[model samples]
Target chain A: MDSITPNEIDIVRASSSKINEIDFENLAFGNIFTDHMLMCDFRDGKWQKPTIKPYEPFLLDPSAKVFHYGQAIFEGMKAYKDESDDVWLFRPDENFRRFNASAKRMAMPEVPEDIFLGGLHEILKIEKEWVRKGKGNTLYIRPFMIAIGTGVIAAPSTQYRFMIILSPAKSYYSGEVKVIIAEHFSRAANGGIGAAKAAGNYSAQFYPTKLANDKGFQQIIWTDDATHTKLEEAGTMNVFFRINDTLFTAPTSERILDGVTRKSIISLAEREGIDIQVRSVLVAELVEAAKNGSLKEIFGAGTAAVVNPIVGFSYQDEYFELPKIENSVALKLKDKLTNIQYKLEEDTFGWTVKI
Target chain B: MDSITPNEIDIVRASSSKINEIDFENLAFGNIFTDHMLMCDFRDGKWQKPTIKPYEPFLLDPSAKVFHYGQAIFEGMKAYKDESDDVWLFRPDENFRRFNASAKRMAMPEVPEDIFLGGLHEILKIEKEWVRKGKGNTLYIRPFMIAIGTGVIAAPSTQYRFMIILSPAKSYYSGEVKVIIAEHFSRAANGGIGAAKAAGNYSAQFYPTKLANDKGFQQIIWTDDATHTKLEEAGTMNVFFRINDTLFTAPTSERILDGVTRKSIISLAEREGIDIQVRSVLVAELVEAAKNGSLKEIFGAGTAAVVNPIVGFSYQDEYFELPKIENSVALKLKDKLTNIQYKLEEDTFGWTVKI
Candidate 1:
């Protein structure tokens, strides 16, 4: 194994597959897993040869750094099966690049392109049946890294593990999501770790999200740290707002994540000649637009939900409801993106890669 | 086991101790572990009875939530053995209370007081030899909680593991420290998990601290997230300043941790009839005082260091050196706290608890 280059991946197949036991029609988003997974270890100054092994539990020391210091990062993507039983991935290179970027911000080691992309390609080919063929059914691909150093110190770990897990996912949200604009809580500060897809970033929102859930909202539109007046994101997704026919969204900054789905939507809208404005959106301006009926639509973009439409939002004890429309921007964009993902349309953008 | 109440702890002794192989004189701060550890599980909507067992590896699923979402929290404390072979702890109640407070912030179930205190008492008595005698030698105690649910969804875990591990420590810092005032990076935000001892809060500071280290600074003095003017904290410790015989420190807030050592020093200063000002220490005012020769001293307070004196600070590329004093306030406070911890002097506040 030490003699092998990073691209020369080793394979270890599981004795059997659990596919027959899984009920695809009644599947939860992330509860079911495929037979095989990809793993690589960072040791002796570099990443070793990648390996595809059986998915199993690890016998780790209780003092592993990830259990104490939270030096962990992850990426989310999806694998879809086309009508012709061909497997395709949407913009996997973007996720590959972003994963290394996240590792750098957390002071962790970067995974080489050969290892990350090559391992992902090989694993998807082995577990191709996991990718269900349907409009909304797909295999959710999770690429994650963790600090595995067996020392109970508050510092960067010298050892790490990078692994990829696949789960069958249905549509993330069943209906239009309702959100509340954060008035006091903040997600990340300027020059903070908010831009990285760190594990801690997601857990920090659970308590505040529960608060919003109790008040009848499914998510929160995080605002600026200095003043909760400018909307930044909506619970792990990048937010976009429409006033009349113009679209407005907060630009990627040190305080907001640069999502792959968000950038794809921007490119799609620009090609379609849609008026898109990527700038800081003030909460007051959004509320005013909603009151005056110019706020035509709101939606979020992410891997879990390619396009999640927002039906209403609450701010400062006042709720503003968005009217339902036929052929809305969100509906149109979701359809277009899904069609491209499933290879239903021509590969004009060349975004899909077949395994 | 299911019938046992939360207060009834079960003890499982180690087959043998590793005391003979240890070098107490050359111990690192958090590397050497004791023979036994305390662990408890949280399931079925409540904390199970605590158990003491040999320290060893844990068999965990690859998808434990703590490794992916970072739902983890911890507390730091110490145990000292007096010259008479009796062990004592300083204000363990404070740590117990704060641990649960952190749990609530991260949406984790709280560890009952009975379980926390009861387990500590039992484990300390069982591993009494690990607590070394004499000053500057002690047992560092780490009590931590982690989400153990084996799922890939971004939600709070239904299963949790709360454990306590002890390590032999020989002081944290050696010399008078040098620090740099943070101007670009923020430790946390107003509505963030900074106040809680969340694992992510500590890991987020590692990259920034490395930058300061590259510039020959031992630590960083973080400032307000909105405006880098008011001082918040220094590394893992709360900072204090003295100018013309008057002491000043920042008041605790949502962005600053409510440190046990910080509050203890404040009480000690008040009892000693020192003029202490608990308010925001602006950067402009501090710089002005340093230039006018009124800035007497600077130091940091925390459980690990007790009191660490600072010799200099750099801000905006300019350095400010503090004067060395024969009887500095930092020195006095450190002596008082350590004396009480080791049972060498009268614990006037009844802070020392015998094990």
Candidate 2:
């Protein structure tokens, strides 16, 4: 739990930049990366010195525990550049706390804040050029940790690697997203590692999501595994429902992630005086709301897409199309949140941190 | 789905074997590996050529999906050397089928039989010297697949790598194992990836197991997550209970693993005219039986420890010590199964296959 000073980090700059050969406007999400990345190793019950080096591949043994036992955790955040070319990180401390929580659940080492946050600050300063000066052009930050211990036994690893890799990204927009309510497959269990930002939780949804995709749906709204009645999560993000001008979202629990964007939206809605309910939304309740024409909108909130609006949803062989309306709460909240991130508006909540 | 002939495998033998340096008398389960290993890459919609080269570390991108999303699966099997120096495998086809099922569930590409089975056969032949002659000595085989696609996305990877690494080991023996019945933590959900040998499932049990270890117990007997009333699995293995004379085991469901050794034990017990019931064993029933002196035995069945007998278990904070009885079913079954595996007993079921 030792704190790492800024001087303790070793820096190795890339000789050349790939920025000139790239087109930032037309970029795929998480496809291209910044020139430099941060890495730190944990071994012998202690964290090693942090290093910011050129982004490249690293060596691992064939029997590394990460490859066999999946002891890994990750976080997703973004860095924004304002018109004055000042870089800002949106609620990075939240991600740092959640990352350690995930590490504890996965039985991995908890990264020191100085290494997690201070190393992030140092790396961002070195790669600030990758953050373009625009509201939509942000640098996606992926901080992940994996077990590097070389053994295949089903036990906690003694060695681990914490890394931060940056990718330039544009505003994410998935067209006309349609979702299906899950009846069988689930992303997590009761008293399981669902709330952690663990790697396994995401891949566990891929097969079910693929099945939904084959049926012309973009995502699945997962339900409680035991009864499959309570709606839990939308794809990998936290979901919200709008009924009769009121927003409803499930409270964070062991089965649902405490998403940063989700909490921000709840705070923004409360400040804006929008009627929002934090409770479990059952399937029957949603069906009844759709039938009575009270359901106005459905959206997912996460780091990748700050607010993703859903056009329709299928439930038990029945499809319900949400009515098109002006002044969507989802879009309004997204705009306000992004404005605060880009420093266009006053940071009333003090969520934005200048680099 | 193309078949790879023996000649299709490219072999690069190690210049010298490390067999001399390894003390065959004393070795850890997965710590020491043979000189050569098998590897094959999947890309551009098809698997490339398979290679058998010197065992060593390999490079991977920091953003590999396996590290970020846990898109990986693995199988554990062991190679046995009979008295005549002929190596044998026990029900490898079952492992092959299960491996692909795991691949399908994780949304990774299915490996062809040639690349999986054929590669193992080729590698075992080259490292045959590592397989010693004895019933307790074994060459543990680990076949695994991981997503090698470089992206920070949450979707399935288009690229993957399949490999086989052999580790020499003695018989696994954890002395006087005591277990705790799970009340909160769970290994799998009702509709989760518990049946597949997914890497994530193993790591999910580590934290809970560590908690049990701290209390002087070796492992946790996971119960149904929804109600925690039915016994599901023990550590990473399938659990069996004996009440009076009849043996009881929970049927394999979405929350339970369909273990190879577990099925073989069921078959062997039937052949020996031992009463065995495949149904859900309730926790309350087990406690009542323990109080009535009918709960005779509890054991775990898996590849690593073929038949791991539990000396005692704690349920609801009440410790229950099993009476030491002669003619223990667990040891009897373990001996019979090993005899058949080592070619000492008659191959009545035709389960063993020559490498």
Candidate 3:
């Protein structure tokens, strides 16, 4: 039934390189792209030949539905280069599955597993130089699908373009990371597109996050909409709380992204025999824990920042700071995750997918 | 800071004409486009001179954040041409206000009322012929804002572009609608981006709406996330249910859009001395009403399809059909609203904005 042989793809080297133009050190999270990108079109009811070409603009009509209706979905994962110059992906299969999950929510065509994995391999392999060799340095791969049909219908676009662009990056957030727990705003709702990494989810967050930034917090911890008591996620990153000797994180809900890192950390925590709870952590309970000296550390977990320690958080006009300790779980988890990513630690769980 | 003089505005009409290329009779919702478009850049922290230019492709860098992070917001409203050749907008001011509200949520810049109104006026005035004259026909104007700065920072974009594009003619949804009352799905969440017509909100909906479509329902009536028992809205339209001759519509919340037509319908119902309830209507209550013959009608209100009555609805595998009435509020309100829109009736509420 497969007309085109599996693993068949076209390759074209970039005529020129933007590698010289992008400053590796000053690179922001997702902005500066590498020399080449992977692109494929879904037409005639199937994905066409995947192609790797120079990262440049396409001749898309302005009336493309994606620009108008937001018929777009994207995935965020990184490719790390270890000491031996070998590149690795921390369970890109999970990202592929999550990407399809997002696509299903947005009514986009689900990319075949082979196509998604092939696209990623094709992109990272060609732009291997974009993978920076150092701690907190990696090639951020942005795999996105956009509705490019030249029409403005308030419906789903029939045609789509799936592309994977690589960017050399450092930590998304620099310096001390602080956040506010949102009780007044929601990123998404149950029975809504909250679980999908559709483009609008991040855009929906910019305002509230900006307000938090204005209040001296680097990010926001979105709480459940009904009562605003149960912590959902950091929206972009899954959140973990360290209370005394035990660690707790909110279980995945329809409203929170089932983050790749969030799940991995759960496995890692179990391997190390640390006490952990995957349940709703009420904000009131967390505040009480902070006041009772039971809160040891609170950090965000995600692909961008493996473990971002939260310095302080404001909730209901009350500010609370978690006590810092020399023996902190955030520091230890960060080391373990990074070591697995950089190939310094044993891949006990086989989480590392070598490209 | 009033700067733009209409006489000095740079105007360049689209050289290519796609209007003739389109089949008006067979037109599908937002798929076709007209010739000209309006654009004004936000640079140096101020809106630049607005330009009416040819509708064409945009020269965007590959790293434009809108493609990845979904940094965009938009407003949907229509311009109606009366039999006497007068073009009117139904409460365009409400659209402008809501647009900014969405802008605030997405962290896009607020478009000044004057600029937004002035731009639409200019565009509509120039493309007057494209504003179809037939009943139930109009020019759909899409006013949108997109983050333009090509930086990959996972933060708010520094630069933005406010644009107005025109799509000629036809209703979005065809025929009498059948809806499914949501029990497990939600449109927006409390303190979430539900109230805003942000682009992401729409993208997030495509997949869920598809599920409803597959279930043989044309659209869905989204319910509150807290319990998923109370009815909120249709996919794109505000919902209204009639029980024992009393009109009831859910109050706009942080999770519901303050629809322009919705407010108009409320006022029209009140002015006509019709009993109305602006409160939550539980889904079970409506389903029970359907069982007991207390439910009269279910209608959806929005810009595209003024007031669409749901012929039937299904919940928990039980289907209920709304009996066709001699003069349903859905039909009456639709006529009244369209009359005011087409300048056939008195603009008692002053919703008509003459172009």
Predictions' DockQ, in order: 0.78, 0.86, 0.67
> If both were scored by lDDT, which would come out higher, candidate 1 or candidate 3?
1
* TM-score per model (chain B): 0.97, 0.98, 0.96
Which digits, one per residue and each the tens of the lDDT, describe model 1 over residues A1-355?
0223434888888998999999998877677789988889998889987898999888777788888889999999999999999999999999999999999989999998877887888888899999989898999999999998877767888999999999998977676689999988888977789999899998899899989989999899999978898999985689999999998989998889999889989888887788999999999999999999899999999999789999999998899999887768877887888889999988689999888
Candidate 3 wrong stretches, greater than 4 Å: A1-7, A20-22, B1-5, B16-23
DockQ of 1: 0.78
At residue B196, give the lDDT of candidate 1: 88
Please estimate how well model 3 matches the true structure, expressed as its whole-model Cα lDDT.
0.82
lDDT of 3 by residue, A150-191 (tens): 765567878898988887888877898888888888887877
List, residue by residue over B1-355, the lDDT tens digit for candidate 3. 1234466457887766666666777777776667888888886788887888888778766667777678877778999989888888878878888898888878888888657888788878778878878778888988888887776556787888888988876877887689888888777888887888876777677777788789888988888888888898885899999998899999998888898889999999988888999999998899889999989999999887778888999898889998777768878888888888888889888778777
Q: In model 1, where do residues sit more than 4 Å from their true spots?
A: A1-7, B1-7
Number of the top lDDT candidate: 2
Top model number, DockQ: 2
User: How many clashing pairs per prediction, in order?
Assistant: 0, 0, 9
Q: Which should have the higher TM-score, number 2 or number 3?
A: 2
Q: Write the per-residue lDDT of candidate 1 for residues B209-258, one digit (tens) a residue.
A: 88888988889999998899999898589999998899999998878999
